[model samples]
Target: EAGVVQSPRYKIIEKKQPVAFWCNPISGHNTLYWYLQNLGQGPELLIRYENEEAVDDSQLPKDRFSAERLKGVDSTLKIQPAELGDSAVYLCASSLDAVASGYNEQFFGPGTRLTVL
Candidate 1:
């Protein structure tokens, strides 16, 4: 079966440009994750969702970055006025209900790499 799918695998934009990334998670997976991976660093959790509710988003940059999983299916992350420091890989991941599944095995998409010039 195919895993999570992300669009626009690569994007290049000048600084201060707005960018958005799309993700479609696996069927029946109710947990969604958004992560940011900087060069030479591990992925950092940007936000997390259970069904359509954002369960964890403390790490998300409220000023310029926002995300939504409207119907608990597809998700979108947007970064307005993107900065040079925002150049990184945005990853989408999904997993079955962590509480019910008893494990946190997440399937990750290829990710969208954004470059700010």
Candidate 2:
């Protein structure tokens, strides 16, 4: 099975600029998720899409961040007027929700490391 894929593993942007990250989840998976990982902390969920519905996005910073899961496949996350505190790893994960309830086996991408200066 193919695993999650993300581009531009590292990124550096000036404050106020916009940045975007992409993700391609595993094949045949029905659940896609995006999480933010601050330094020295575990990944905090930003959004989760079950097929096409954003079932969970309580942790997402709505002020400047947005996401989408069109076609219920690949997804993208965008940050506009980025802030310094937004510097962190953007991780994408996919799970076969049909085969399991818990995300213990979710496959994670290498992640995109962003730095705001």
Candidate 3:
């Protein structure tokens, strides 16, 4: 099977500039997720979507970050007026319905690396 796809694989920005990242999940998957990973840290969950509904997003920084999965498929995450602390790797993952009868393993895409100056 093909893996998830992300564009620009790397990004660099100065603080206060807006930034956006795109994600495309694996086919036949209905659940999508966005996560953040600081250097030397495990990926932290940002948001999870069951199709078009964001089922979990408590960890997302609302002041400058927002995301959407309008078609319950490809997703986009945006940071307006970015901050230096926002420099981290943004990852996208996909899995079968989490509650489905089976082991639901999250398959990750190559992350978009953002560096804020």
Candidate 4:
């Protein structure tokens, strides 16, 4: 089976522009996550989806960022009027289970590097 898949791999845009990222997780995985990683910092969870429901999104910025996991299969993350601070790597990860069982290993995509000038 294929691992998580992400598009564009890299993106460059000016501040105040809109950008979008896409991700497809592994088959049969019930849990999906979107994370943001600044340089030299660990990935911080932006949102987490259990199937089609967003179970955790406390860290997601609601004003300019939006995300959706449609039909429990695919996901998209969008940043409108992006800022220079938004320049970072956006990572998508998935696991077989949604429960916080501590044993589930998440499969991660290569990540989308966004540069804001």
Candidate 5:
């Protein structure tokens, strides 16, 4: 009955440092998503997971970013060798189905704000 949960609501690190974010989706949700939002821009999908399989991750930066949703529940997103441009809010959302529609509402966590100096 709980909503999505994320850790370390805020994080600050220097460039080249590594940062990690965690998310726990709502119970019974079958789809999960990770999104990146830059200031004044809408959230863009970084990765999407259906159950334990990663269905989409084209927007994710493979060079320094990695994510995993294990056992179809908890998920983690990591950005290594963080860059100054990586400063933004990382949001985690979950839905009851993969095929998003007007009837399916996605619940979002407060999100993790990462600052790279």
Candidate 6:
């Protein structure tokens, strides 16, 4: 079933520029995730957080990428000084309390595609 989705499905920017993406998860869902998908590859988790607390962000590129969940609701992901390698589809997902719900289904957004020039 189709549900969550991102805005400005496509974006193009010059190298070294910055970009941001927004996500609004399903109501009542307490867990949110951000992922990056390269061409011909599966999406990889960049960050996952519960409420406003980040629980997993080891895969995120701290040097250039950052994410935040505001008031445990809407979330945003950003990239600064984007490079050629940063071009990819950024996906957002949400689920029930991940730690307590044990394997809850994740609802994913269509994703925002970024192209660096």
lDDT of each: 0.96, 0.92, 0.94, 0.96, 0.94, 0.92
Candidate 6's residue-wise lDDT over 47-112, tens digit each? 998999999999999999999997998899999989999999999999989988369999999999
Please name the candidate that would achieve the greatest TM-score relative to the true structure. Answer: 1
Runs in model 3 with CA error above 4 Å? none
Q: Quick one: RMSD of model 6?
A: 1.5
lDDT value, candidate 1, whole model: 0.96
Candidate 1 lDDT over residue span 42-82, tens digit each: 99999999999999999999999999999999999999999
Ranking according to TM-score, highest score first: 1, 3, 4, 6, 5, 2
Of 3 and 4, the candidate ranking higher by lDDT: 4
lDDT by residue for model 4 (33-61), tens: 99999999999999999999999999999
The TM-scores of all predictions, comma-separated, are 0.97, 0.93, 0.96, 0.96, 0.94, 0.95
Q: Give the clashing residue pairs of candidate 2, or none.
A: none
Tell how far residue 90 is off in model 3, in angstroms.
0.5
9-53, model 5: which lDDT tens digit per residue? 999999999999999999999999999999999999999999988
Clashing residue pairs found in predicted model 3: none
Tens-digit lDDT track of model 2 for 22-97: 9999998889999999999999999999887899989888999999989999999999989999999999999887
Candidate 1 stretches greater than 4 Å from native: none
Better of 4 and 5 by TM-score: 4
> What is the number of residue pairs that collide in model 3?
0
